[model samples]
Target: MTSEKRSIAVRFFGGAGNYTTVLEECCTHILTSDPTEAALVEWVKSNTKATSTDGIRDRLRFLEALELLEIEPERVRLTETGITWVSQTDPNVLFEQLDATVYGFETALEALQNGPKTDAELGDSIANTHAEVNWNDPSGPAQHRGWLQSLGYVERSDGLNSLTDSGRALARRRTSDSPNFQRQTYYTQADLEKAFDTSFGSYIKGINPRTDDHGELSYIIVKAREDGPYSDELDGERFTYIGEGVPSKGDQTLTGANKALLEQAEGASVPVYFFYQPADRSDLRYEGLVSVADVRYVSADERDRRVYEFTMERLDLEHPTEFETLAASVTAGEREETDSDANDGTNAGSEPEPALTAAEDEYTEVQRRVRSSAFAKRVKSAYDFRCAICDRSRESPAGTVDIEAAHIYPKQENGRDFIRNGLALCRLHHWAFDTGWLAVSDAYRILVADRPELEGYEEFSRLEGAQITVPPAEDEQPHATFLAAHRELHGFESV
Candidate 1:
């Protein structure tokens, strides 16, 4: 393997190895029964952290290959390799990384252990612990608290700001001086796997051998600090400090002078690398660069294939027409719901209202056009560029028949483009599904007609109520009115 490949493998292997050492030590201290029971308990306790003794046996299976320690009914013993590796590895470095990653929950756990705090209290604690203390800037606390919440760390639940288990671990790890504190203190090997997968493990697969400028495959990686209100300070000290890429690129469809203005900003997280793609002259198609979000891993060996190469997770925004449709429907529904609830003395005005400012109007237009170009991309991610309506799959991201997000209700008839209107359908299905000859039932089930044109129609029956895979849900939810209306109006009962 190339040095890059070896490096990638080594990082993954090392993180896993470090976690094993920590698990063994923690387990030994916790379980003192039969050696076998102790081994099992050790494994479970390692994954569960200092919290509870759940899933000890299952977690042991996860780290079985490490063979850090051998267990028998009567005695427990460390393996030769485990002993040597543990002695050599730096516990502090491993733990710090683990704290930021696998043990990220530790931060929250620490807070929870002390008892629940309100959002303001939790935010204050997080700010005090994580945010830079800017003596010149007094508003630092609010800013950092919002940032932590965006990343799914501390959340407000039942009127209190609480740390997730991951958050608790992170908080606890922060107290350690060892760089490897997290390395030796993970909640589970699986959690470590996921972190590495999202942040580094994926780099091993699909990362191109070369980087491109002004190409669809190009990415700009930068470290961004959280500014207040979900905005990114792209140019200042708060700007992203990416190792190999810039904070922003010209080609990404979402590229604005800044994108933090969108409604999605409130929940935005910082210190993440944003990915982008370039579009051609027609502005009709935007080639996708990666299917997953940008991962953070330091590549070693510049000449090695794995070094500096990267891929991204897929993100498909709903079609503009559909987005407009959904936005309108949501607005209308909110109005109706509000009016109905108004008579009952309840204030139904808690939701954020969509403002139709000039900038927002421009954003609306941009989102619409880009949604179409992003169609093929949406399908690629759903099943590696396969037709969800038809079991067609392709290894090549560009080789498949382009699938589009089909709307159950026609936009012309006032159907919204929310996720419910969005379906990853092949070109043929897009046409047939839109024409109302084929309809979806009120229960969100698919129904095909008994047409002489489509022979061996067992295919249609198989698709009824078949769950349609989609990109990660992005606030937009599937609405029932459109599907119900289509079926009722068409008299097909399946619409």
Candidate 2:
């Protein structure tokens, strides 16, 4: 086992003067809540950190290495190996594991056997005891003192580290068993507010993105339902998210939320965390950390105007579409109900509006945009993501489906968002149908306008009477009312 010790400079373990109490408390916190990165940072700032926000995460990773907790893309949680120690009256099981893993454990014991040593001397005695791996006080001696104190093997007085009675026995015999050591409970939320030095209540948005006062992007929430106002589409490994803006009111310009996400594509180091809100619950699930892969200004087929679309690449989250039953944290329970202003577009709440100039107008438009997205998704799914006109289906290597949902009677004409009023078409046919070049008959057959002189007519005319592929559910099929209205509006002869 000693031969398998990490060959790197990880001579010491733990982070920023971490203690056994800190590790045990954090592991226990993971037992009841999803330990999202944001929450964990907040926790460290309050409980640790006399100076800055540097080593908080390292402490969490320390807990991970201790086999007391596990970290995922979205959140951290307690491990079953941790389950035994968190509830045990004595933490020697974990301390013994630490004694086995961390170097310099016996060196400190052996040195203190002679007499008490000053903190500096004790630190020196422990440093570089192992071959080629060295560490500073915070990662090395400070952490060593902390765990030693936790195990009741050491005590400190006036800047000195000395073995206790147990420590002396352990020092003399080089072995000791600890008495029962009761630990205190951890308050994750109270700790969070205190650490970040801010008051936080429940957020009232469906999607919330957190940016600091300095305008740094922290994380985003992706809330999905089978049919919802916005289409945050998950295709293969790529996530195509509609930028926050309502398209029905006018053209979507990339400003507010759209701009922030677009900027993420530029910096690879910028970590954009993702949280998933299950439609049926108020609590959110951590999807994982993601980075922006691509952003586009699109002339959307459904909206008939340009809107920003953000494509995101998952870093470590593989099964976002599948959720495991993980515990919810303070971040989840504190969420309030309301969603007009959920962040520039990670869909939003809690942060100051960066695009305040257009706040009122934009909020009003968000509702319409969400509705339009839901309609398109419903229509597209009903047709199994295939183009009805030519019966062609295609998906990009990037996992993007090429089919689009089209409105038969037209949004400009105030057509309602009903299943019968929509059709799934490829981009070519979608444009052709919208421009009056083609129509769908009440008999569900393809109809092309009398344009023998039209380009591509030779191939298109052959499909004149071909039946349209439709949804299996009768309720989802195209309605005769909308089809007849579309035929008449486009100058198609009655069938």
Candidate 3:
């Protein structure tokens, strides 16, 4: 208890600088060669010139005041707020940056979905190719690239660049939010195989087959052209032998250099697609072939341009492939078991699924809910689609108006998981509400009485008397009974 008091005292006196110093020490101590309290103390002493235990405790309390350090027994760690501060200095600025990175991420992802690119290639491949990045300024693309790399959105591969899955997910979210772009870029069969340098079924789709001359034709699955068996015109009928292994694995289907060449040669941007045909050795067995193609470029810079001439009719969709059948069967079985359990209440106390599976399921559910068209547009409507805290609107380019549905009584707290228990909050308001620094009252007004720093925030000051955005229908108001119960449960006054 003495140690705890001493630590709090130090944190109380610490300023932002001291907080930074202590945080650096904690990170270097926790993440480096040594992990000991003595080592951490020595590191802090070097920065603050404090020797005695009392001096260290004083500095630590100061750091706590700055919100940079979290104290545990014999160890210190940086809080999420601290990490955000250290990374970008201002949480609001960092959030904006994250949003911008997400936008740029969408543009790059379209290219990646079409084909692979080097870092330089992706920067060039941005859809707004004509716009120049303010390289003379530090707050520019170069800086943003570093930020993206730090956040695990973009990655380096053999001097080339690629998008991580999280990056793709973010891009999809941004794309779904905006309607300017049609479909994310598509790739040809040959290009698709070349980009990944590995084969995976999930990433490949939209195959188109074509033939080369001399009756020595090749198949262009989407944009990927594959050399097929040689053929000759006989009696106006062409007899051809679709050769096996026309495309060797080592072929350079699409390269950064290749994309650059196309950009220069065309004098206009072209959508890219990775293309490939199956690796079937037998001539007759090429019937049920699959390939991956992404549509990245559209002709004439118009939304209505012919992106692809082929549709489902041109492609063979009658036969389900081996992988397709297997996946379908597994999904069917799982659904059956889920339904059976739901009805009979069987296995009521069964152990939970594996951690990885559970996490994946949760992540998938979150993504699904967030990306749904109706939910994406209306989530903000519950709060009148404006920020319950900041009231920022989509009209302001710098400010985001989109709001996410947030829990008032946390879902984990046995709060009813319904709209009445939820508030449509902008990202900033969402963070503040979730952190317990602010909350809504039973009267549907904002409250920050316990949080002095936040109490004077614009939302609380100017908007206190303003009713939060209510549902269009009167019946859609938060359940009065639930609100009463919640206020009673939390010891909050009705007003």
Candidate 4:
């Protein structure tokens, strides 16, 4: 196929790797509750840092193209086929669907069927087949290679290209009518359990049989430190955590295991299963198959040693029980049931408990504590307990740092208690952010509002137009909408 055709196909069909995020978002929103297009867009913008509606529209269109979504004039919902696709535990089936649906994929496969060919040879073959347009450009064949590799159909070794067993099978069974078309056996959960054998040990011990390129086991054990410098918690379809870099004896550098873990995570092409163990117990509470969503390198101490911070999205499962409990606590008032009280015999005619002023106060306090604690944990972990505005932090005696989580939009305004709505700031910067003196831009540049009283203050003046310390993932950074709201609230112009 020609490059123009390929480009058009990509625009219509969506890029190979790009579909996963949007698909996950769709499944998440649909499963949570049916949401309108506007609600989906808003949720994505707030949670995923999506800047425009076009990306969302294109994804929705792609889903419709693939027959995964049933789009009506006013609403869109998943089709039965789409629901099955999302619910499947096997990744191979998802790969097969992509290979079968992507535009120009079949033609590219046909070209590679005869024999192993270099990328240039494949491009030349495709170019010769279509004389109407140029396919000789690097991007033309590179796009094909990318799709094929992402679908697990092809591999490259020593600069030579070859088809995997699945690729060979796909090539031979090109026609949809063929019995073997897009068919392959996959490992079942029972099979994995049998092979790994967790009866006498933990899930971590069970999955340790497989090893990866980093000379470590295929899976990494993440201990959820809900109360410290390195912690982890789940938020909807994603799990956020601080990367491991606890100081080793006699040296302040990162641990060797952590270094290897970071390298593998950073370079991984496949999803890695993370077995999450709670702080109080050593046994595994839950396991999530995740891909690294974000990573940031931050200074570990005064010695200038650096460590990685991670944000991971769960690709294979729903939220665990612990996450559900925490989520329940944060949104308490909305879901609390008063039916029992209303049906009680003694309280039926007794003024309906009169709002229980003290109880209401206590409930509000509990909500704030739960929401703030979770929000603070995520924000502090994201920035490695360093201030975004001033880049200062001190270790507390309890192993926690002195940084605070400051909300860009206050809770009274119906702002969500999410990572995007928070920033890790030192005590001084937190005060400045709460007041009108300091604000941040969507671009993450520190904007100091024109304050006549602080004209001679070097500490405040030096930060004007300075870039704040942001998370590695674009989506985890402070959202532009929240930043805009903060700026407007503080009467600050764009810097």
Q: State how far residue 304 of model 3 sits from its true place (Å).
A: 34
- Against the true structure, what is each candidate's TM-score? 0.29, 0.32, 0.26, 0.31
Q: What is the lDDT of candidate 3?
A: 0.40
Give lDDT tens digits, candidate 3, residues 322-357: 223222333343354335433553366652221111
Q: What is the lDDT of candidate 1?
A: 0.38
- Listed per model in order, the count of residue pairs whose N, CA or C atoms clash below 3 Å is 59, 9, 44, 0
Global lDDT of each model?
0.38, 0.59, 0.40, 0.56
Query: Root-mean-square deviation of each candidate, in angstroms?
Result: 24.3, 24.2, 26.3, 19.5
TM-score of 2: 0.32
Instruction: Specify the highest-TM-score model's number.
Output: 2
Candidates, ranked, TM-score? 2, 4, 1, 3
Question: What digit string (tens of lDDT, one per residue) describes model 2 on residues 1-495?
Answer: 133342121212234234555656666667777778777777756765423444556655656666667778688777776888878735446655566666777778888887888756766776656645654545456656666776667878877878766566445444422111111222233443453344446542333455667877544444333344566776555688776666456666545455556545532323344545445654444455555666666777765676667777665423221111000111121121112223334534443222111223322232333334455767887887799887788854323457877888887776754556789999889998999878888789889888899787887788788899999997678767678778888888876
The lDDT leader among the candidates is: 2
Q: Per-residue lDDT of 1-495 in model 4, one digit per residue for the tens?
A: 112223222322234434454555566576566777777667767766457788867756656656567666556687766777778623345445444554345666787777777777777776776656554566666666755665557777765567765566556545422111011233333434563343324333312324445854544434353344444566666655655545453222334544444443423322245554445654344455444555456665676655555666654323222222333444343223234323444644652221111132443432344455456666777988799887889754323355777777766565655666778898788888888778887678887767657643566777888999988975457766678787888898754
Of the two candidates 3 and 4, the one with more favorable lDDT, higher being better, is 4
Worst 10 residues of 1 by lDDT: 1-10
Tens digits of per-residue lDDT, candidate 1, 1-495, equal: 011110000111112214344454544443343355555565544544433344444444323333444545566555554454356543332333223432112334455658776545544454455444321233432333333443334566566666544345345445532112121132232342353233433322111221234532222222222322123223322222222223232112222212221111211111112322212221111221112222223323333212121222322322112222333334444454435433543355553222111122323443333332243233344444445456454322212135455555655654443343456666666676776546665444567666646654665656656655444553233344555666666667534
